[model samples]
Target chain A: MKLTKFAMAAALLTSIAFTSCKPKDSEIKANVEAALKADMKMANTVVDVNDGKVTLSGECTDAECKAKCESTAAGVKGVKTPVINNLTVAAPVITTPPPASTATVLDAATQQKVKDGLKDINGVTVDFTADKAVIKGTVTPANRMKIMQILASAKVQSDVSGLMDKK
Target chain B: MALQDKYAQLLSAAQTHGVENLSVAEQNGVLHVSGTAKSTADYDALWALYGQIDPNMASGDLMMNIDVKAAAGAQLKVTTDSTNLNIRSTPSTEGEVVGKAAHDEVVTLVEKTDDSWWKVRTAQGEEGYAYAQYLSPM
Candidate 1:
């Protein structure tokens, strides 16, 4: 009976040893993260570990770089195998809007003021477009002076001629 | 106001734009300004202001060193929920996608363009912009 109990105890200890031998999944992930962070070349890559197998995914400039990243992750402690997938070897595209010109910076309130001041002028329409204060049709001398005053801060361009002739 | 104090407006603008490591000093009629601009736009604005203050750079008294802060050599890990993060040439979604980063990949940060886009260089030297939200600095 003593021998039978001893055999059962030995079997239980053997099972416990096998279970404790492998590192937990969380612990493996932490180590992989730390290892990858130390390397500048692996900056854009992400690391995930599951049951000691690591999967690296992100943009890679080339196939060789991807291999390097895989190897780096594999070298980390507690990682048994490195799996690489969908690593691309292409450059990132950067498309930015053109810089805003000085004309665009002018506020709408100021533009409206210029338009309101020129409303009473006969056959004359004042519009601010394409960075210019456009004055169309004709204006009296007094109205022209008012337009100038309202658009004092803007660059005035006139389509209508003979509005301000020195006579 | 002193010569350095004359640049207070520019300094204030730079700080508001998130320029890092800002330093301003005046000595021998020279204003030495140094800071790290977050984007090329901010960098250009600083120089443009400098030009306006001193036309044609004639004075040569202002020594300004405004460096663009890029993630060029920074180590960053990818953090996507499941779908791969798109790496585009431009910062906007309309930008053409040149590459992709799988979830949990470690990549080098080339630069952070503004706060929205991060320029990252992959191990293969592939460089592009990724959404700043997905990249975790290490």
Candidate 2:
């Protein structure tokens, strides 16, 4: 009976030691989730922990975010090898930039400012025909918005309309 | 209030402790700092890095523009220009004179004390301290 009691006590002690050494599974999950959302700005990732192993999944807005989430999750303690499955990386949004050509009533100086502004971005092909600037180019969403915002800042007298979308 | 207060407290602690080795973290707006510092000035430099702060004071927009050395153990070049150049153990002239450098021998800056003396290393990996005035870029 003493031997059985001793064995039971040892088992209990071993379980306690294991529990203390390993952080709570919920804490690990919360940590992984918070780290990704805070650092990577990923709203789609899901975190799960089982016996100290963490698995993260879901689509991220971009490739940089996906990589950041993986690295950050690995850095947090209590995560033994995170299994990040085939995470879908959505292509960044590409906003169409308005062309600089169409000014209804603008002076030479104003036109020059608009033209100079359009020239700042590389890979942007600007074609002017009939006082209408045909701004054609493919740019990342952020850059596209920045270009449009610059044009708006020019305060041109001309009307900028019908920025084409070719593919 | 808590974040701003925390940053102020940490900044004060850093100044009180030292500034030479300042390591801090600015998350959300609360700046969490640890490690050794060189002086009060170094502590101010660390706070200055927080060019902008978040509304809640939990997020910090740190703009770091430090011109760090290109390589580890990189040789910083220093040239002695003054006619009477003095190599002092500390940044001040009153500091104990440990060694002397030539008129144009460039040395690498290994460490910087709060005072004027800079610990510099040469191309030959020789390390020593010199007055800031007599030293110029190679």
Please report the candidate that would top TM-score against the real structure: 2
**Model 2, position A133: C-alpha lDDT score:** 44
lDDT of candidate model 2 versus the reference: 0.51
Which window of ten consecutive residues has the lowest lDDT sum in model 1 chain A? Answer: A153-162
Error of 2 at A25 (Å): 0.8
**Per-residue lDDT of A1-167 in model 2, one digit per residue for the tens?**
99999999999999999899878989998887777767547656887788778777778778887787778888888888745555688877899765222223344544554554454355666555554345566654334433443333343222223333334
Q: TM-score each candidate.
A: 0.26, 0.29
C-alpha positional error of residue B97 in candidate 2 after TM-score superposition, expressed in Å = 87
TM-scores of chain A, one for each prediction: 0.42, 0.49
lDDT of 2 by residue, B37-130 (tens): 3432443344433322321111222212112222334444433223334455554444575665556665666675422345766555545665
Model 2 chain A poorest ten-residue lDDT run: A155-164
Clashes of each: 33, 23
List runs of model 2 lying over 4 Å from the truth.
A91-167, B1-138
